[model samples]
Target: MAEHTIHFGILGCASIARRNSRAIKLAPNCSISALGSRSLERAKKFAKENEYPAYVKLYGSYEEVLDDPNVDVVYVPLPTSLHVKWAVLAAQKKKHVLLEKPVALNLKDLDVILEACEANGVQYMDGTMWMHHPRTPKMREFLSDSHQFGKLKAIHSVFSYNAGEDFLKNDIRVQPDLDALGALGDSGWYCIRAILWATDYEMPKTVTALREPEFNEAGVILSCGASLSWEDGKLATFYCSFLTNLSMDISALGTKGNLRVHDFVVPYQDHVGRFYVTSDLGWAGIPEGADPPPTVHSIETDLPHEAHMVAEFSKLVENIKSNGGAPETKWASISRKTQIVVDAVIASIAKGFEPIEIN
Candidate 1:
């Protein structure tokens, strides 16, 4: 009830929301004020299992959460198909929105959500938790160092997890109506975002999907890859899947240096994250010696990246509520750029793996 605190209403009881609820609790200025789902009983069970504070309100429908006068922010972990609908409604109701990644099925839908937030003066941020990790900025510092990293020439990102039989057959990600984009939206999102982050959000000139994406019977992507080319000869490739081993890697090669991270999407450890950098010399003589081993950089955090994300978002929400500040545009812009690239990937796949211009 503090003036600077943010009251968050969770729009669903999805599996991801449980992790987000923990984040809300850890965020300094945020509290889980309400929980809502299609089924009231399910919502109650989720609230109970998550150990939400007794003060948390439970609602039978998402509308009730948006209608609550006390809820200052709405966290949307709903399906991709429902994101624009509920997110726009939440924004229109003057609730700041913390939406899950792949912000929408396509850029068009994401734009609608963004426009609503802008019109309503509500803060909007996607659930790309890695962006808040301290290690990310440190990596960016290395990438931007011309003397160390030089000009970025190429990058590759991979993110995958073996979903097993039940997931491929029963999960919402593989369902056509619920999350038709499947692995591309669910997993590839991080890969695309990482690529964009490495390039400072400079969109690629064109995107071409790798041939033959694996698809379920419902025609949802289970695995796919794509190549992106920038105007200045910078190139990037990314692979994502729900049918492979757990692997998350990003290799960014520059003219003079290279950066590699095995856990770009999610770190193995919650408190500390690491990335490697190799700079200056390469191709060592056989007898002389190779460049020194890639220097390992680890960042320590008091809270998990997800909690950091929530805290950062809540700070913005609090500023708008207490200081009458305009909604921050940086987060919305990044979400828009990420979705644009995702749309291009989808378009290229649909067009028989031809290159799609990123106009």
Candidate 2:
């Protein structure tokens, strides 16, 4: 914390890495000190294109990046399957880790990554950037206000995309080794996370899953629904899919009012949109215009680097510098629970739509 800057290394040259690289550059007191890729030419090219400093090294192997003494932290933006392996290796070297989302393919791998971090006394965290956004903080605060949404009633969330066959053909997101990435993990996780995040993971005492298997190809889930406990005496329904055209929306209903957010997942560069709300009193619109409304804020730039990657990586740096590091909380717990729901959906499909309750 004493220094004005922190040196870091990137472990992959994928598109995710490119976004994280730009975020680190933008974050105060953080810098990409090195980069590594499986291909020597790729590593060199990436380093040159980014104008990484002379001290910033380029390595053909990720291990070399981990071994760099100048590298205080490691950003692993590799495939979903490789997340656990690289996290463990970086932790072994006593390097703080900024791991990509989903943490790992399953809970077992997530435990190992956490164990490695604990054993090595290094910080490790999954980068759920949206959860760290200023709006997220505001959402939490608003949800607590009695007049904001009144007593909770039910909630619904949706996140869908038409990832054409071309993407599935070559992307690891669709590989069997990667757990047949489909609606469940590919885009569905966003919906699950949103529910847990919005509700503070307070509901969902028991979850029953149902999947529309026809939307799945190669055994990957395409559409899913879950019956969850919305409140003490109420229940909520959830839905997500990746086979649809495109949709990203969330709604939380209550006795007094309701909050509906449209295009929630990825807002535009200008963040211009209308989030509608209705109550017994009347209807109102919270428009994100040149200036965002209260409780809603836009990223600092019109560029792509303004993505959630900034908030995600910044949290890693802040935790690493805080000595004992940030305390683990419902965030980690809810992610594990969400994965269980995904598994339950898979089980339901295998059982001919027989609903399975999440333990």
Candidate 3:
């Protein structure tokens, strides 16, 4: 590996890893140097199918990936339950960690992962792909504009995908042991992160899970919704499921304006993204005609959002390795806030849909 390049070792062969593998390849200073899975044959197959270099190392266990001296970073695409285990181990091994979203089953486990990374002087980041998209900053710019957007009044986010019979019956997301949080952890993670992003990571004063979350026979969530309220009376609501038509949206309403994004979680395409905004929206000519249509803004990116995430993470790793820079805490902070809200939502559901206060 070149001195400036950050070598990445993948810890799982989950379906999401394929997209991440391509992203690693797309990043300028990163390489997918190794892959590890419980089944060596599966690891080998993943390498071949993903078109990784012939020299890429394949190991039979995740620990070996962390043990590799050449690996400067480890990407954990494991299930939520396994995150703290593998992510902490990788951090203890002095390898920077890029973990998949829903950083853990709860905030306590997320803290364990964060502490390990901090103690080991390794960078930590969650794999929230949309956060690295160029469109995000543009949207934030509009939301922060006092004259155009005024004060935020409400936020509504929804993310869902209709899982077919095979997925509903066999997917790990609906399994009790593999992904216990189910749709809440898988789909709702994005919704919560979107809400947090729009609100600049402010913690809501209380969170209440909507009544009657749909669950499978194993008692895993298949669909759910929640409402969050801030101390200043700002409100946000989110819905997530595995039983609806594919949709990813975030609509933020303010006193003077509103913003709408149809593809906030994953864009319609990799190269370009779009969003709409209507500022100072009101009646014109005594309700005879409304103001002009919402302005549509499109952003074009040379690399995919996942690739941008990889590149950003790798840059931090490179800085720490070569320049003796301290690990960036911003990503870890955001992950913690997201997990806190997720835990509150779970608590509310367990308490029979009562609001859970956040401290």
Candidate with the greatest lDDT versus the true structure: 3
How does candidate 2 fare on TM-score? 0.83
Deviation of model 1 at 102, angstroms: 1.8
The weakest ten consecutive residues by lDDT in model 1 span 282-291
TM-score for all predictions? 0.97, 0.83, 0.97
Higher-scoring candidate on lDDT, 2 or 3:
3
- How are the candidates ranked when ordered by TM-score, highest leading? 3, 1, 2
Candidate 1 at residue 209, lDDT? Answer: 96
Error of 1 at 178 (Å): 0.9
Per-residue lDDT tens digits for candidate 2, residues 28-118, read 6577788889988999998888766676788999999889997878988787788888999998998877777656777777778878877
lDDT of all the models against the reference?
0.92, 0.67, 0.92
Residue-level error in angstroms, candidate 3, position 14: 0.5
**Where in model 2 is the C-alpha error above 4 Å?**
1-4, 49-54, 214-217, 270-274, 281-331
User: Model 1: per-residue lDDT, tens digit, 1-359?
Assistant: 33227899999898999889999998788898999999899999999899887889999999999999999999999989999899999999999999997689988898999999999999999999999998899999999999999999999999999999999999889998989889999999999999999999999999999998999988999999999999999999999999999999999999989999999788899999999988875566233564457888999988999999999999999899999998989999998888888888899888999999987
Worst 10 residues of 2 by lDDT: 290-299
Give the runs in model 3 whose Cα sits over 4 Å from its true position.
1-4, 285-292
